[model samples]
Target: MARATLIGFSAVAMWALLALLTDASGSMPPFELSAICFAIGTCVGLAARIFSPPPPVRERIPPQVWLIGIAGLFGYHFFYFTALRNAPAVEASLIAYLWPLLIVLGSALMPGEKLAWNHVAGALLGLAGTVLIVTKGGGLAFDARYGFGYAMAGVCALLWSSYSLLSRRFPEVPTTVVTWFCAATSLLSLVCHLALEETVWPEGAVQWLAVLGLGLMPVGAAFYAWDIGVKRGNIQILGAASYAAPLLSTLVLIAAGFAEPSWRILAACVLITGGAVLAAKSMLFGRDAKASAGAGA
Candidate 1:
């Protein structure tokens, strides 16, 4: 479980590069870019399959698993892009990032899971840090005009959190199944691109390389790692730690000269790091700590 949770953190680390890579990929339409990157992501999974083939039982994965997998990947992205289009980026993103907190809260419903005080506190602290990062300590004034977009962002949060939780219920399902989900998402994204967006391909070698980088990291292997983590890892810790993505992303942007440094970013780093440590207190200490925590609860 610890190893799987660490693998999940790798996904968050890869996601930190998403903003930098997308910025470098030029002004391609969202769906078009999604299609292309996910196509490469599909190829990535295929290459892995060639190296280590999954068992025959994995081939007989249930239909509901496929449905949930595709819906989670494609549905979350589609709504997220739509929300960004319809609302202010800062507001939309802040709302969408509630998935981690939602996951922490929702985990109580999972079988044999305990909703501890530290878990909730850690999640809330992470959310506070995320808010600082997303809003840059500025006030949010949500206008009535963007209500639909705000609602879409809420849906994005629910979809992703539910997806992560639901994945836990199907521990028998292999992570390799994510490959098919990526393939289906790529195809669906292509269809959406054709219908709703003008064709605008990546321009130069740099842009092309950026696109490939996105596919190989954030969009590709990240999902695979996440699948394994959510199915068999310490989900509460994963939920709290997920907030580190935005902080890491902001730092990456600053390092790449795409964003300016701010005191808020520094503060967010402290809060997020502290929250992760607090959430993982049991794992860091020992099973005796966990027993004590459970007794207190």
Candidate 2:
């Protein structure tokens, strides 16, 4: 479980690069970029399969898995992009990033899972930290004009949280199944691109490389790692820790000179890190600390 949780963190780490990479990739349409990147992600899985093929029975994966998987990947992105288009980027993103908090709260419904004080507290802290990062300590004034985008952002949050929780329900399903999900998402994205967006390909070698990097890491291996973590790892901890993505992303952007350094970044870092530690107190200190405290008492 610990190992799988660490693997999940790797996904968060990769996601930190998402903003940087997307910025580097030229102004391609969202769906078109999604299609191309996901196609590369599909190839990544296919390449892995060449060495270690899935079991014959794994090929007959359930239809519901397909539905959930595609809905999760493509649905989340579609709504997210729509939300960004219809609303202010800062407001839309702040609303969409509620997934981690939703996951922490929703985990109580999962079998054998117990909601704890620290979990809720930590998740709230993480959400607060994320707000600082997304809004840069500025106030949010949501206008009715962008209500549709705000609603779409809310849906995006629910879809991602639901997807994460649902993945836990199918522990028997192999992570390799994400490959097919990526393939289907890529195809669907292509369709959406054709219908809704003008064709604008990556311009130069640097943009192309950025697209490839996105496909290989954030879009590709990240999903595979996340599946394993949600299925077998400490999900509550993972949920709280997910807030680190935006914080880290901001830092990455600052380091790359795409963004400026700010005090809010430091505050967000402290909050996010502290929240993760608080949420993972059990795993970090374990029974020995409890025993020592009890003995001392």
Q: Global lDDT of each model?
A: 0.92, 0.91
- Which segments of model 2 are wrong by more than 4 Å? 56-59, 288-297
Predicted candidate 2 versus true structure: per-residue lDDT over 1-297, tens digit per residue: 677778888889989999999999999999999999999999988888888865777456778878889999999999999999999999999999999999999999999987888988998899999999988899998999999999999999999999999999988888888999999999999999999999998998999999999999898888988988888777898999999999999999999998998889889999999999998887778664555344324
TM-score of each: 0.95, 0.95
What is the C-alpha RMSD, rounded to one decimal, of candidate 1?
3.3
The TM-score obtained by model 2 is 0.95
Q: Candidate 1 residues 1-297, lDDT tens each? A: 777888888999999999999999999999999999999999989999889965865456888898899999999999999999999999999999999999999999999888888988998899999999998899998999999999999999999999999999999988888889999999999999999999998998999999999999999999999998888778999999999999999999999898998899989999999999988888778675565444334
Candidate 2 at residue 100, lDDT? 92
What's the lDDT for candidate 1? 0.92
